[model samples]
Target: MNDRDRAPIDDTRFGAITVRQDGQDRIEVHGEAVPRVTLERDPAAEADPQIAIGTRDRSHLTMRVDGAEVDLLPAKGRLARHSYRVDVEYDGASYRLVPDSVPSSRLTRDGTHLGDFSSDGDETVIAEWREDRELRPADAAIGYALASAFGTGAQPMWMMIADGVSSALP
Candidate 1:
């Protein structure tokens, strides 16, 4: 953990979030007027296109920024909770998104816990990041998708709570 007590956060700014669902298989992530990352499924024919190939669940997800494509590959993770994971590199830094059974997921980089994000099966999502680390909006969006209904084994908060309540009743 970075020293939060030694010094105030030097730079930990969060881009104002606006996550919009364009269709059944698309999510647009925007900060201010510029788009950060657009996560969606690619047409079967162009899935393994010019971009680098991928692995794991083969969800065929396309990660785009301003209509330009970037590699969004899947990786092996705790599949008992989530279907797959996204392990990518940005600015020479490696990031991993791990999904959970609840409506939330974990974000780690270089084996250090960075943050968590969750979605309530709607356009709005919540992202909490470590105060000392820089925030990457793209990671937040991917984690949100993995925690929301868009990904496998993701259940909403209400459903989990109701299940717990019902299970407890005699």
Candidate 2:
């Protein structure tokens, strides 16, 4: 665990959030068991010229956090029914979700990819800087995808709920 992981616990305003990989995508948060998930079959299993080469279909990805499950795919519409991959839109920024590999997932925010996560069988490790932010349902959904693809713990994105402060990127 690092300082970023402890901020929420040390500061009650951030609440006590603990995300650690237990098995597969399953995680433990504050002693609560978070469920693991696999990629759902894409409705449009057809080849997508947009997806990176070597990438496979993973339509539905779910992540459980704090007793709540968040689905990364669209909740409604044709894309929800057809596309296995989904992009997240929030605060004017778009987060593109992609399955780089079976044990890796990538989240690209506004063209500048934040980072990627990989599963080590026993734990999840982020390849770049990981920050805590106040996340919405869509944001949380993406977080879960990262956890599932990387087989890591979930990050706390509801900072505002604990302390009315803005930790999101500008």
Candidate 3:
């Protein structure tokens, strides 16, 4: 498949947060210096929560309290919106964690592709491939850096990451 046919990668470091509560209900957040957005939890608010946090720019992160898994969408703003249905087992119960999909238009003005912001079917297929794809750390790092460097409202960062990877490919 051509590079254009692949799902876009977001490498921008919009920001990150590590939360810890000092033996209290309140949570303490830390990360690289950036505007702090609130961590919106599930309605249940159960301990050891499984949560997905999204930003106005379409950046998102899904994390589990017990650290069983953590997925980072560093450049979510560059791609289309799609649903991620995750199953989590906690406290002897299985909770289906399906986050609201971020709209594709909101992510970029490049319009939708087969896997762009509005195609859940395409996103799911690409995600599955990503899990099995053998990508070098350097390639991944370069993709991330390019996305961050070229970010702006006018140009889609995903496209930039794609171009970077394509040019680097043998």
Off by over 4 Å in 2: 1-17, 20-84, 120-145, 149-170
Backbone clash count for every predicted candidate, in the order shown: 0, 2, 3
> Per-residue lDDT tens digits of candidate 3, residues 37-122?
12222333343321122121212223333333323233333232123322223334332222233322122111211111122211
Candidate lDDT (C-alpha), each: 0.53, 0.38, 0.27
Note each model's CA RMSD in angstroms: 10.9, 15.6, 19.2
lDDT tens readout by residue for model 1, 1-170:
22222222111344454555544455665554234666665445343221222123345676666566665556544324444456655545666676654656677777778787655544556666778876555555444444332332355556756878999999
**Compared with the true structure, what per-residue lDDT tens digits does model 2 show for residues 17-131?**
3344432323343311223222332333453332211123334233333344443443221112123334554446676655454445565667655555444422233333235
Comparing candidate 1 with candidate 3, which one achieves the higher TM-score?
A: 1
Q: Candidate 1, clashing residue pairs?
A: none
TM-score of each candidate?
0.57, 0.33, 0.18
Ranking by lDDT: 1, 2, 3
